[model samples]
Target: MTLDEILDSLEHDIAVRDDGLFAGRAIIDGRCVDVIGVSRGAFVGVDEALWLSAQVMETIRRGGDTPILVIVDSGSQRMSRRDELLGLNECLAHLAKCLMLAGQCGHQTVGLLYGHTAAGAFIATALATRVLVALPGATPEVMDLPSMSRVTKLSIDLLEDMAKSTAVFAPGLVNLEKMGAVNATLDPAQPLAAQLARWFDVQPDRADVRDRLGESHGGRPVAARIAQRVYELARHVG
Candidate 1:
């Protein structure tokens, strides 16, 4: 689904603003929530990050039991000398912290990924959400396979073959689900608004269980065990 279609489906009432930013009040299952959409894909810079941070902060300041819906389609962080000079990393970190604050203040955060979600853009925005849902055929990745092959010195064909069977380093929505990075995948033909309302009504606020889910799905067998061992060691030392 495109950004506009998703918004139209999920939001009974919405107003689109200039420069790929939009805010609206939505009612789901008799509960009201605030929705924000950022459509500036390809590259998200400091200004965009700060704008998102402010939106999240304002929601927390309002002090209501309103959930936050973030519609993300960004590909990566902006690559420019000016953005770097202006502390892009710091801006992204601030955005992440703002989302974290909203969660701490009892705001349920949900991310709907309808397009390209990659690298720092994914981490600073969508990955910060409490529940992440992706549309069918949406690709979320750290880096493209060719780039990964260059970085890791693996052959492209080998990586492709590995991706066919294992999702440890693949760049697809199904792979993300297998690794527990994505909570659920939505069918495009289904009623998106009703599905999202059901998710909002039923999904619980809980600690990250991606590792456990990954193990259960047989994608990452040792991650949970390794984490437990490290925690045990730390407890013993302390």
Candidate 2:
């Protein structure tokens, strides 16, 4: 879905201004929500990441404890010498930090992935949110199969076979959902407005719970345990 289609699917009154980045307000079930997003499936570069960070920080400064909805339809980070030289990684990390900070500051940060997003773009936006709500057609991937095959020095067929047995390294909604990356998938056929309203009423407060969900879904059985063990060790040392 296009950005407009996704917003329209909310079945709410929305007023937005866009300049590749979106900042708007929507009324869902009579509750006002602050909506922000990246448009055009952009290849997130340093400039885009920094711009997004500023927008989120400005929302934080507004201090309404307003619920935030981050809509995503983006490609991976820009793969170019210019971006790298300018510290793209730092900018993306800053963007993710800003979102996480918003959640910490009493804003209920939710993500809506209505279209394709991958790699750094996926991580710094949707994954940083407290709850990520995905639509049916959305695609989220850390790495595409072909790219993975190249990196791992395996044949595409072999990588495909491996992916059948492991959700840890593959791309697709099924794998990502199983790994607890997607909090929920909204049915486009249903009334999205109602479904989203329900989500707002019951969304989890924890900023990050993917590890626990990963364990429950059996997509990543040991991640939670390992994380806890590491946390305990670090705490003891501290």
Candidate 3:
């Protein structure tokens, strides 16, 4: 097995042994939030990510901050042919939307990954969060390099190079860092709850290292600045 696959396999084993759910309580810089994650039971399969959407909304409705820390370890999909056939994109989009809603509603969405966090599995966790915490051994690649070659008809080496850039379609933590996909590549030994508590306390508006990443490496902030200017101009014009 490749180094990446081995790491992912180890993570998948550990998560399985640990049993998937870890719930915790803390005040993130005085903002009350109940952090939630997954491991076992009802939360399995391709449909699993969708389950958390309502839970997030309900947390907001109750005047409580309910941030989700997704513990991703599953492969792309196995029994999800039905999901794909039945418009899986929309299903996945709804889940992504819900995670954004949590972020917009003053709740922090976090992704903690080990094992193989690939497929829709990658998007479900990575795209939703304001901050992401991953172990050094984690394999965040979009797909094993060979799969991309088959689908895209590009040389594996070229595809590997492109995936390295976060601004491009590069998967994994390093690429995600540039695309503004993940906020932090944290130490796995630090404990999930403790790290979440720390970032949660830091208000999202302030530019942290993660925010600076997009601005510095990818020049992504240029677009944001333009958007901000457009909004201001529209307001004055109106």
Rank by TM-score, highest first: 1, 2, 3
Q: Rate the local accuracy (lDDT) of all candidates.
A: 0.81, 0.83, 0.57
> What is the TM-score of each predicted model, taking all chains together?
0.91, 0.91, 0.67
Model 2: lowest-lDDT 10 consecutive positions: 11-20
What is the per-residue lDDT of model 2 for residues 1-238, given as tens digits with 9 covering 90 to 100? 5677778766444444344667777877777887878767778889889988988899899996878888888888997999999999999999999989988888888898988899998999999888888888888998999989889898999888888988987798888988999878888778676777766665446536798997898788999999999999999999
Candidate 3, residues 50-169: lDDT per residue as tens digits?
555555666668765555555555455334677767666666667677777777777666676655566665665555667776656566655666877898899988877776543545
Off by over 4 Å in 1: 40-42, 202-206
**lDDT pick, better of 1 and 2:** 2
* lDDT for each residue of candidate 1 in 91-178, tens digit (9 for 90 to 100): 9999888887787778888888888878888888888887888997677887789989999999999999998888887887878888
| lDDT of model 3 at position 96 | 70
- How displaced is residue 148 in candidate 1, in Å? 1.2
lDDT score of residue 24 within candidate 3:
43
| Pairs that collide, model 3 | 8-115, 20-38, 20-39, 140-172, 163-170
In candidate 3 the C-alpha lDDT for residue 213 amounts to: 59
Evaluate candidate 2 by giving its C-alpha RMSD to the native, one decimal: 2.2
